[model samples]
Target: MDLAAEVAALTDEFSGVVRVDRAGSTVLDAAFGLADRRHGVPMTVGSQVAMASGNKGMTALAAMSLVEDGTLSLGTTARSLLGDDLPLVADDVTVEHLLAHRSGIGDYLDEDVESDIDDYALRVPMQELATTEQFVTVLDGFPTKFPAGERFSYCNSGFMVLALLAERASGTGFHDLVDERVLRPAGMLDSGFLRSDDLPGTAAVGYVRMDGHWRTNVFHLPVRGNGDGGLYTTTADMHRFWVALFAGAIVSPETVALMTTPRSDVPAEGQRYGLGFWVHASRDVLGLSGYDAGVSFRSFHDPVERLTATVAGTTSAGAWPIARLLEERLVTTSPAA
Candidate 1:
């Protein structure tokens, strides 16, 4: 890929970081536009940007790690940990089904139903969503969509339930456990869930275009990310994560294989999906994609070639144009419409 040229072509639409790593060395590191528009702080390669649902892969890794250690099993039911919390989840919904998106559980953020990126989707205030335990209130009222193990249905609630299960199974906070097992071992020191209200100097502020003006997305998203999304990471850290995952540092190679094995074919998306990661239809690339009210992000890695490419943008639609450039060059010849 003409990484520089492709990124430059989307200068007007893309406003974030793009990084590519090859053979364990940085091949491309570029940043554009503003990280904080009000203060005029430019986005940089080091700026930590939110990954939205892209971090679902990390959540999957944590769950798989628990399974490897016998703390949980693929057959373990969400009800085992949930007790009477979400009364709508089927008793037969297993961890594996959840991981593979076949749990048939109703999603709180149903992507199939919700089309507006700028809409106020949350029922409660954003501050009330700081902890996994607090999310149960919002997850309520949704009915089960299908029988457990019925079919592949991308679910945000499935991952949230996994986060809740992870907390109960390990007796550790979801953030701490992910850091301990997924980030720390992978050497991703630049990544973590940060409070949207009190962002650090190194973090990027997500922006939404409102009535011809730009505003921060502090109200549209949760204060702190949960199982499904809302984690901030840099391009470099993402490359490290991919390398570490493939090198058997974060989890066993066998476990990694299981997670990346294609479980369903999502033709609407023109790709396949594994347990927690988006699978390439005709290539060896495993992908991560996230799109929220103010954040857009995607990462694709080829284990055989040791290539990792990631793009993150502040506006929800900015990253995709650049992502298509990368996808066309590295992922597949027939891109999804």
Candidate 2:
């Protein structure tokens, strides 16, 4: 698909990183724009960028690890562990329902309802939302959208509740559990939930375009990532993640099969969904995507081919267009397709 040629036209404005790895080797690695415009720090392939909702895949893995070790189970109801924190979630909502996005629970950040992307969308200051427990206040008040297991309506709060469930069941923090069960075993040394306010030099600054000016996403998103989103990783680490996940490093081979097994047909997304990853509607490609006020990311992996293509950037919209191009190319050329 002439990867370089496709990415060239947008080089002037694309702010982030893009890379492709095939069969244990790098096929493409390119960095564009800046990590921090204020400091004039150019983005590098090593620069860490937020994955937004893309982190859900990791959250799912963390929950599955608990299941694998008998600390939790798919049949475990949210009410059993969460108690009275989120009273809106029905007692029938289970861990499996949450993983498959069929929980039908009230979503804190409900996408079905129309709301602009801003800090005000959260009921409290974004900075206060640094941990999974801190999210209950903001997650409060939204009513259940449907009956449990009624349908596949994507719910961000479902993952948050899963994190809470895992924590209660495993006696571990959500972020720490993910690190131990997902990132650590996946060989993803560079990925973790980094606080947006105190980012390290290796991480990119999330920037939202506001009124013809560029601004940091510090105020528009949570201070530290929670269940639904907010984790940082380099393109290199992301590639490692895909490889390890399929190699049965993060979860069992049987569990991997379960996770990648398509559960619902999402026509709106033009794809099907497994546990936490997005499944290709017609092919063997698995994808992860994220978007927010100052973050955009998408990663596609062909398990059999051991090929990965990822587009991650600091702006809310930069990576998707390029990701669409990559997906089209992959869908056509994937061996399993």
Q: Considering every candidate listed, which one attains the maximal lDDT? A: 1
Give, for candidate 2, the lowest lDDT window spanning 10 residues: 114-123
Question: What does candidate 1 score on TM?
Answer: 0.97
Name the TM-score of candidate 2: 0.97
lDDT of 2 by residue, 1-337 (tens): 3877787666677899999887888878999999999989999989999999999999999999889999999999999998887888888989999999999988878888776664456767878898888888877788898998889998999999888888889989988999999999988899999999899999999887778889899988889997899999989889989888878898899998998999999999999999999998887789999988889999989877888999998988888788888776666755666
**After superposition, which runs of candidate 1 have C-alpha atoms over 4 Å from their true positions?**
333-337
Scanning candidate 1 in windows of ten residues, the lowest lDDT window is 328-337
lDDT of 1 by residue, 254-326 (tens): 9999899998999988889999999888776899999998999999998877778999999999999888888
Clashes of each: 0, 0
